[model samples]
Target: MRYSYQIVVPAATYAPWLRDNEFLTLFKQVKKNSLVNFYQAYELWSLVEQLEKVNGDVLEVGVWRGSSSIVMGSKLKQLCSEKHVYACDTFEGVVKSDASRDNFYKGGEHRDTSQAFVAQLVEAAGLTNVTLLKGVFPEETGHCIESRQFSLCHIDVDTYISARQVMDWVWQRLSAGGVIIFNDFGFPMTQGITALVNEYRRDSDKMVIHNLNGNGILVKVKV
Candidate 1:
């Protein structure tokens, strides 16, 4: 049997307009910054637009209050036809990992946003193609997604074990020329994501790592 592999080099596009103007304007208008992170939003949107050009679906592993998901999913709906965006989260906050795993957050530190809240936000945004999968990553979450490939996957689980598990599950499902953006790449707190990326690169020649915003992106290209 022959295994197929491909790598993609992402074209990094900076939208200064979002930073100096649009995002800031929205930040003030909304009266809260809870749903927006300028850098993450801009970079993800750039990746989404590129993926749209090729007709691809989007998947996000961590969604808090549906802010980022709303942004990306809404844009995807506008740019592509019949393209789906899947958002997976426990909705009950991070679950306890095995004690051996590093970077596991002790209980009670993070807030758990309910599924109802996320659903309300998505509905208010009028996002049609967005699907919400409520559960932990790589386990209950895996059942929610079909076997279809994804053009872009955003992993933001924020811990080493969760990040690695999410990547391991999603990497092979990524289409040729798809991109996997790891949100906690070089951040000292999320060393597992960095370690996983390094290990993946050593095992595959077609993937390229682009470090951005304390995050690392693994782009798949056709070899």
Candidate 2:
């Protein structure tokens, strides 16, 4: 028997706002100064748009050079000024990558940043609603925000170990209708992360996973 599958593209995928000049301006601004490319930065802006509908705090794991964090903070300030964006990153780099699964990265791969540098970027952007946590997740930074609930969580750590750890930490704490965005989900280099996300989707009943470009969107269903 032949199996069939269909691709699902949301209506909002081509929303005019994503192509508007304002978004383009912000996208370029972040790309020019931050470490992420246009596609990744654009995805971050699109994900942040989900925050206008949800309620709770925001979190970003594996922030590199503060590009995505800045995008999130800027959007939150414009839409929900009361909410704070917690930017967590080792700034030291990608932790140890699973040698057998991850092909493109190694221990401390993207470690060309520091907490102070990101903090300065945030401050310079006039974003006061940001908290920068510098350290390994679920270890140093995770405990600090363990008691809080999140409406939006962005996980870009390019490893299975870190991705799984952050997922465990955030899934239960995610508010109803909250959105969790996973970066590099469709990339070949981080197949380990792809496996982790796939396993999670298989085991999860309350969560729905959608793929968009190089990202995975997980939205909590209302009970």
Candidate 3:
């Protein structure tokens, strides 16, 4: 799997100047209700904007209240118009967590959402290229996008089990020059995420890891 593919990590690119104002405006509209801070929000928005380096779709594994989805989908509309963004989640919080590693979260913790609610947010953002797949990760909804390829996959599911499963599901299908952003990696409350990325690093030698805000980025170095 490692030698069969290659990943082109573009020299850190910048978002279009015009999109800066758009990002700030869109981010502020949802920041107060979002789980991520400004720095992290900007990082996600900027990274998605940089996906112009690759030609493929995008995926956000966890969509809490649809804030990140709104941020990414809005930018993707202008940046990667042909690449649809897939927002996959249970829409009922997380599934069973690894109690041994995951101390703060349990199953059903962030269950304050529904597909209808997220759909409303996407619609309100005027983003027509976003698809919200509601279900358990990989197992339940993975097949929904079975044969699709992705340029970027954001794994923010907040669990060791879910993150590992998402990584397994996403790695092969991710395109050359693609990136996998792991949210909450360095976060104290979500040490499980950190552990999960470390495990991947130990097993895979072809990935280039980057740290930004509280996220862990894995850029595939070989296809």
lDDT-best of 2 and 3: 3
Task: List model 3 lDDT by residue over 72-132, tens digit each.
Answer: 8888787647878899989889875988988678888788888999898889889998899
lDDT string, candidate 2, 1-223, tens digits: 0122345466765555555686677766667656555666666676677666777789999888888898888877777568889989988999857877676788887888888988888998889998999889978888888888888888889988888889888888888888888886767677787777676666544565646566777777852
lDDT of 1 at 118: 81
Off by over 4 Å in 3: 1-19, 208-212
Whole-model lDDT, candidate 2? 0.78
**Backbone clash count, each prediction separately:** 6, 0, 5
- Give the C-alpha lDDT of model 1: 0.68
Q: Judged by TM-score relative to the true structure, which candidate is superior, 2 or 3?
A: 3
Model 1 agreement with the true structure over 1-223: per-residue lDDT tens digits? 1122234345877557455464455334332424335666667766777876553578888886777777677667666557788999887665544344445454333355778888987887778878899887778878767686788888877666777788678767887788888876665555555666667776553575755555577777752
RMSD score of candidate 3 (Å) = 6.9
The TM-score of candidate 1 is 0.79
* Regions of model 2 farther than 4 Å from truth: 1-19, 33-35
The predictions' CA RMSDs to the true structure, in order, are 7.3, 4.1, 6.9
